[model samples]
Target: MADPWSKKNPFLSMMLSGANAWAGIARGIMSGQAKGQQAAAARQGNKQVADFWTSALTGGTPKRPRTSKKRR
Candidate 1:
């Protein structure tokens, strides 16, 4: 029997959406780094950027990033 939920699981979809958000965060980090910012700062900023969507996607709480996208 096929698992009907594969069609659209909110958790999976939210995670995917979070992935898209992380991609933006990565871009922000890379741009900040190319300009010579501290690694720790970049990571902290990235976390904040990622949190924007993660929090929205997974209730008001921040969720861990699932995957990141490449600039294209």
Candidate 2:
């Protein structure tokens, strides 16, 4: 006779395995989202620093300034 409490029951074993699988999938998704957000924040910070240095070196002047024609 097979014990009801044991993993001998196919239905009970399948249900338990399915629950564990779902939990693992959920954890993976959450972890991936967190990593993506961190990477995005790092990229934004690097871009800001680059912009600051460029402006400081260039004295905040436009690359091409418009010249108005002088009428006599």
Could you say which candidate leads in TM-score?
Answer: 2
* Model 1, runs deviating above 4 Å: 1-6, 35-72
lDDT of 1 by residue, 16-45 (tens): 999999999999998988777567778989
lDDT of each: 0.86, 0.92
- Candidate 1 is scored at a TM of 0.35
Clashes of 1: 0
Candidate number of the best lDDT: 2
RMSD of 2: 4.5
